[model samples]
Target: MNRPTTLALTFLTLTLAACGRPASTPAVSTDDTSSGSVADAGGHGAGGNGAAGHGDHALAAPGPDRSRLPSRAVLGPATVAPGLRVQTLPANVQPNLLALKVLILSSGPSDYGIGTARALLDQSGIPYDVLDASRTPLDTAALIAPDGSGRYQGVILTDSALIMDAGNGTYPSALDSAEWDTLFEYERTFRVRQLALYGAPGSVPEDYGLRYVAGAETATTSLRLNAAGQAVFSDLKGAAIPVTYSYTYPSALQSVPGVSTQVLATDPSGRVLAATSTSADGRERLILTSAQNPYLTHSQLLGRGLAQWLTRGVHLGEHRRFLQVDIDDVFLEGDHLTSALTLTAPFRLSGSDLLNVRTQQDRLRSNYPAAPNFRYALMFNGGGANTAVPTLCTNSPWLTRDLLSSVARCLNTQFDWVNHTLDHQRMDVMPLSTATTQIQQNLSVGTKLGLNMSRASLVTGEHSGLGFMDPTDDGTRNDDGTAGPKQDLGLGRSNPNLLSAAVSSGVTYLASDHSVASQWDAQCPTCGVPHPLNPGVFLVPRWPNSVAYHVTTPDEATAFYNSLYGPGGLFPYWDRNLTYAEFLDRESDQALTHILNGTPFPHFMHQPNLRQYAGGKSLATDWVQAALVKYSTYSKLPLNTLRWDDLGAQVRRHTAEVKASAAGTLSGTWNRSAGTVRLTSSAGTVPVTLSGASSGTLYGTDRAARYDLSGSLDVPVTPR
Candidate 1:
């Protein structure tokens, strides 16, 4: 085939894969949650597997009303040489506008993802970054908010991005050389991160005929109150059936069309035990029943719910939302009062002694109950290898294992774990190989502890490892010989160090600090502290209310602070340098102390240190528990962890079964219909018709954008 023909055919297949739906399989079994609300998007009777495909190709001019045509057009036939890929993005979706960052979540290197995805993106010209998702649990603030890109829309997830076969067409979440290379071949890689649609909260009553809360998610776990209130859990994917007393958490994912909710199960203490979407069905309800009601002895209450509703796309008149900030990290290092309150020295140690240090450090919990609705976060403020000791984060293996084990049980109830890196290296400066190793180590540690997640979980920043990194990568090293960090974090600019690290390692969350919390009119523009890399920085008045970490000395503390009662300052709390005594005395003494000024004090500060306040057998457990309470109290919204693409699995499966009323491809019937463009082949006709310009850009929520030739294909579906 001529290069043009070949390119056209190739584009066709890629477009089909990109624009096609119902490609992914719903992993959750039928009625797995008891409501039996599963759909076959593009599959057979059962949910169909996610199969990538190329679609019809053929170029055309931009249609007058680009919004109406198929932004995603498929090529005619594979043999005819897959045609070129095409996309028609809404003008609202900017090439530089926010909406293309994807956080890939996976378990231990998923299969054949990066390579195939990268090849297509290269051929299709999409932008993205991949990170190892299986590093830490998906329940931390520091881990998920590393660069602050967590706010992006539409996070596309694939487990492990590995190419090795594990189940069905499924592969582990790991990657090899081919996948990495594919990524580089795609569109120019930029540091701009897009947000993922955290499960479009609440089903559209108009679209799905259901009324559900937005951004709600659910999972299941069992707690046995068998021994003196010590919580032991049954595997989430595994149901504990001891004899006839089978404990099944039949989760009812919302299947009905119009009725919706944010229902879930809670343990005895009102902690989120398992997340359930729908209500019970007749003889088909998911009942997490233990012998007698284990309510007191490790029993749970299956109906606690938070509400998160999306306010976008709706008419401005319908806009209404509560204050629910989804936080992932709030780290405190050394004596920086905040850090001292959050992080403790000798941080990454293990055993009883380490537990003691943590115990003493944990008094931070005493700060919890104070900030009820503050955005939440998972703490990774410290505990990586001691840089001077290099091997510290590595050597103190327990730093991860023992700690995570303790943390997981806690996480089963409170918040999600935002996985941070294994060794906290300044990603921008470190060698890619070393960065990979450090991240891999972190993933390995997560495995031992059983809190599986991808590099996407880590909320990271430019100042990892040997100090800060240069986001622009001018090749100048830091004063410490590391990649010279940036002095100016340009406006609306993000750090590439964290971006590259996240995508390469399959990380999901980016580290970022909210510059201010008040409206521009409320404070001085130049007063809020600048980001570490960007000096004399002024936060865009639009998004304020940010509290960033990465302080070891007192000086950094004062930069953001406004003495005691300044109107417009960086944080709502005292300087990180403040002593615990000062924190206590000054906080309540001076009604408007810096303590009460900036974004509210992270709930963690209110609680005691992970170990100090709460006594976990190990520091990790206490850390996890502290993180849980902090998040539970703060991330006040309901959460749905599945990626937007994952939801397509159901739609993809059902769509695959759909046979176009007309046999043959869109190209076969080209020229037959008034607007028809077709190509005839041996078996059937392939046609692509455009009422207008089918050539346009299809922009993803995350920065990745695709150009499709299909005038937006109009498919009408009657709501069930």
Candidate 2:
């Protein structure tokens, strides 16, 4: 294929922009061109600079005084019923094997740390049983099996001491002296590690070799990870992580014989925020003095490490950050908004625009090490491509379509390609023959263009044909000449002809809109919803963003955004019209939540969003890059990108595992000495993730492997 000089010039411009060159002026007039730097976007740099050291003397300089700030709710005094005393257990009670499960001890359901602890375990897919100390009585049976095998490998306490308010002006220990001794005895016998989600330093129920130095400090505090913390949380790259909206207790380590205290995290004053203590009897415990919730940045950053430490780097389920963007209507023309805020039809991406996108993709991967595997998935319409034109670049100005087709063919392997039908027609009411042709003809066209496309995946136009629209249309259309007010009629009303056509065309994964309630699998939030009409095809939901399909420039996007969300507009949520930068900030924040939560849903945008607005940036890439930059501030975990087929299979496996877990049919045991994990399921195949094991992806310092088990299976592992 002949290389166009325009393509080469566009690449040069993009390369210059990527290398910190000054951005070119926008082709269209914009209301605001002040795209703020990533550092100034949010509180991302709150802990960028802080003292990094080890040992008790590793103190940070005192931060700004916030003594006048109101203190957060503090733990009431810990007291047991009068005359309660510790009880001793038999020395011969020892366990040889333990199950790879966790036991969470919480004061009650209202305990804040309960949610925080559960979030960590849930996201990592680790199995855990919770017992309310205030309600449930602890016994040796709960700790050990009949065969002398321990039931849990680790224990998580809502706080250092399970103290509860007795509603009579006294805060009492939910687990009295005897109960506490029972738990400690189990830990001493089984050698299982324990983690306290929150703690107040003192010798109330137990001493962690810490003395309280200060009460709750409610402010954003920068915490530096000490040597012990770095070893436990190996993924953290020795940077200070900000802890916000937390009730913190800064403490000092006290000298205790036969007990070694290692400070994990410390505040500016060198006071402890998190620490680990090992007793003479080999019982180990990790305690964090700060309160945590799932939404906090500190919690998200520390959760995986905490879970790994709790389970000794062996657990069920997997935690992976996924971010995939699917651009729909790739070869087709979409509507565009003019500088005058008028909507116009027939706006297609030029060959130069494609080259700029390719350059930006490479730049993003190079710039953000965490997102090195990122690539865009293009959903294309075959009817819009001009295959009849010569593959070589031509001088004819009217052959823009030919130029686009030629460029796409040349760079076909750079991106993932998916079928978006032939004419981009809605299949809600299409006949079987028409639907089949729309599905198969597109595959043929993709094959003809040498595109690396898959027949197992398909993205129907507007995510139609999956039965989520108004049943009674009244034969009316909207201003855009499309059906109005689509209501979710549920998957039962899905078009049979379309389903059959897709099945015959070998389509296994069908794209659906996540905004539609009926399109997603409610049982397993991260799994693909199996179509009720056709079991062969699964509905893989795609997240939608704020970028409109019709806007090609920032000015147009800003104008359209203001009309819907600005003051005196349709939604009127914002006080004033947001600039393009502010708009991106809000949009990226939503995406960041999904990225942090390990959600694998791919976000969908339109072809117009691929336009290189300015500075070699497009609306689609900007949103993604913004989220990635923010994520980099807190985590170093790689963001996973999967093809459509692989994503579908992952969803299916995850669904099976969830079902098996819920049914209590999945179980596993880890033999420490043998360095092997044996997993078994009474029912169908279930996916089990084991850290420090052989096989699967390498996450952080441990290699987490997933095993699909139907019967019993043994996997060799290196215990951490």
Best by TM-score: 2
Residue-level lDDT tens digits of model 2 in 1-720: 110011122322232122111121110001122111111111111212111111000111111112211124356667865325555544445465778789999887445566667667867777888998889987777888766778899999988887675566676877877788889889998889999987777888878899867553544687889888988887676778777656677889998878789999999888899998997778999998876655466776788889888888877777778888888888877667675666556678877778788889999999999988898999888888877654533334365547778778877888888998887766676779988998999999898888888669999876777775446532222112223334457788788888999999999888876655567754445567878888888888776666766678888777766665579644454778889888777666556655766767787777888988887989889888888877786677788888777777777777667567756799888876777888889887767666667775787667877777788988887666
Which residue pairs show backbone clashes in model 2? none
The local distance difference test score of model 1 is 0.25
lDDT of 1 by residue, 535-641 (tens): 32212111211111222223322332232212332212222445433322222222111111122212111111222323433222332233334333322222222
The lDDT values for all models are: 0.25, 0.70
Number of the predicted model whose lDDT against the real structure is largest:
2
